[model samples]
Target: MSTETDPVRLSFRDVCARRLEWHGLARPSAGSRPADVARAMAGVHAQVISGAELGVGLRIAGATRTDVRAALWGDHSLIKTFGPRGTVHLLPSDDLPLWVAALSAVPPPREGFPEDVRMTPEQTEKVLAAIAEALQDGELTIDELNDEVIHRAGSWAGDLVMPAFQGKWARWRQAVHLAGMRGVLCFGPNRGRKITYTHPGRWSPGFEPAETLPALAHVVKSYLRAYGPATPQRFAHWLNAPARWAADLFASLAGDLQQVEVEGIAAWVVAGDTAVPAPVTPSVRLLPYFDTYAYRVGNQPPGLLYPGRARDRVLRGNFQALIVDGVVAGLWHQRRSGGRVDLTVEPLVRLDAAQRDELGVQAERVGEILEAKPRLTIGTVTVGGHA
Candidate 1:
């Protein structure tokens, strides 16, 4: 363990490159499975499921969207559920116990909704129980699940409280994420165009939540291993937890953490894992929106990761990123029409001929993963940000 008094110092460039290597970006992992990529990424953000598939597909050599889908619905190697920040993610099914324990322990934000819109603790618990019971037997569309929850819990559970896209959502709907973290709820195969939810126990037989402290420790170490030389504040932001709570959590894990300075910024890494590799040569990758690598850079000193115009174009807007040599160098977008994908890359930095060629190769890889013919264009991407 490293002490605050004598922390290891590292350059931002070295830290960025090390993170890329850990993410399977500096060198994509050959013959790795979808679950392997998901595990290395901690979890792939899955608000947009296709984006999640692309994120995992890009990290593993010869991997495709079909393989990712098969891993989720066929092989049962990946589980789609609420992960860090209470967002949908594709996680290794075997690690669900650890993920659930750690996520369930995070105290919900105090002032998330107005008093009228929020569910009382008792109501929340009851709704979660109802959800567990509803999903125990088989998969159910949201509508079916909602009716079952209302029937099992009470009429109060059906009262429209939380405002959604246009109208209010039922009171029980707020507990969806909570149920997922409690290890009772997860995404099931889609019923045609509609999505379904099922009990994790259905697919992960004999599944049980792990002990909280040890699981949390494992999660913290996993984060550090994947995106370390990071501060508790960044971890808190990534997890959507309170900064003070994360700081206290970091303090409790002092024996397992090493203090480090990244370009003079104080951070922590898993103990005994501080060897930085030699600087990597420039590489190009087109990451889909909500890609783990694109999102986990976590409020670093502005120019280090999001250089020049990229801060506004990529980071602030949450646009698909064009990465060059482990930094966000531009924005990219893809439009699919029939069997073809038109890729538009808006580079903030001038690309040399070699870099342009590499971008073309990366675009082709994206096409292969999606099983579409790709046309690469290096120019402005006029599309708006995705949700």
Candidate 2:
């Protein structure tokens, strides 16, 4: 457990600790082709150990909203693709087809949508083609893009048609993926707008495309290396992929991986893997809502946060989290008005003075990032355990 006690054979917690140093800052490109970032973190669940850095860290590191977005998708194809929950996710470009192929294996559970409403693979292909044609070399704002999509799909042909009769274009996640493919959907350029759509092919020239299997293998390897001391089931959950396919990914990575036990459960870690060291004592981090680290756990051990509660909050359009000693020790929320950011902290356990000091400092820093300061208020600390 101590850094002095053998640097090799990192525990799950240990692996999570230094992830930011290795995976984010020390990267060759400071984590460029941000999609590669997902692949790198995939070694651990395709979730970065750091999750969404809070406002404090952003100010301290001089990272803006644009920087974070760029850092997350530098070269990856899809941001919100398949994962354990059929939710949107950021994925590496090379692994996109494989992930799409794997997740598309079984039709997603049809819930409220009628069976007749399902779009077959052929139909989806047609949709993609039409979309590609309309957006291939062009850029459109969200409204313009939606209109183009409706027009190109011929969904707006007649007024008598039922709203349900129109074929759906891309959902939030898919639209982002299409943008990734086109290259115009980049950081800024759109500048703090919602779902700004652009052509990727026009944005970054001379982009290199990696092969599918190799990319898949790389993703599998990265997850085990970064997040390992984890299992295939955990990975399948993180990727929103099939258990069998996760197992296959593990099998393909046999020679490059090693297995270990944490608290009596079996898991795998990459051989020769070393963890980045955290401060001698644990540190606290203020994380943004929906940070990848906050959501990567898929019904597994070393439980990080309140998944059910987090999911509920996200569904309700609200969430803020805190990381203590490299784990999601609490949830938080912020309110911004009149150029001031108000922070509320609800911890699962009691915070010592040191933790409070660290948390307060981080909170102030985050406010600075948004150019909103002191009118910064730390709400009453609520004490409770994470369910």
- Give me the runs in candidate 1 sitting further than 4 Å from their true place: 292-303
The number of the candidate with the highest lDDT is 1
> Lowest lDDT 10-mer window, candidate 2?
43-52
Q: State every prediction's TM-score relative to the real structure.
A: 0.96, 0.68
Candidate 1's residue-wise lDDT over 13-92, tens digit each? 77877877878887778978999888887888899999988888888888889999999999899999988887898999
| Model 1 residue 325 CA deviation in Å | 1.3
Quick one: RMSD of model 2?
A: 7.0
lDDT of 1 at 313: 79
Give lDDT for model 1.
0.86
RMSD per candidate (Å) reads 1.6, 7.0
- Model 2 agreement with the true structure over 1-387: per-residue lDDT tens digits: 112223244455555555544444221242244454455555222223133323212422554444445544543243433243444355554454444444434233424333444444554454455555666665566566656656765553222222233654333223333333322233223435554444434434544344556656655665565556678888776665667877877777666776655555666666656445664343676666455342356323434433444434332343456666655566776667887777787665567999888778677667755557634344543433222
**TM-score computed on alpha carbons, candidate 2:** 0.68
Each model's lDDT comes to 0.86, 0.50
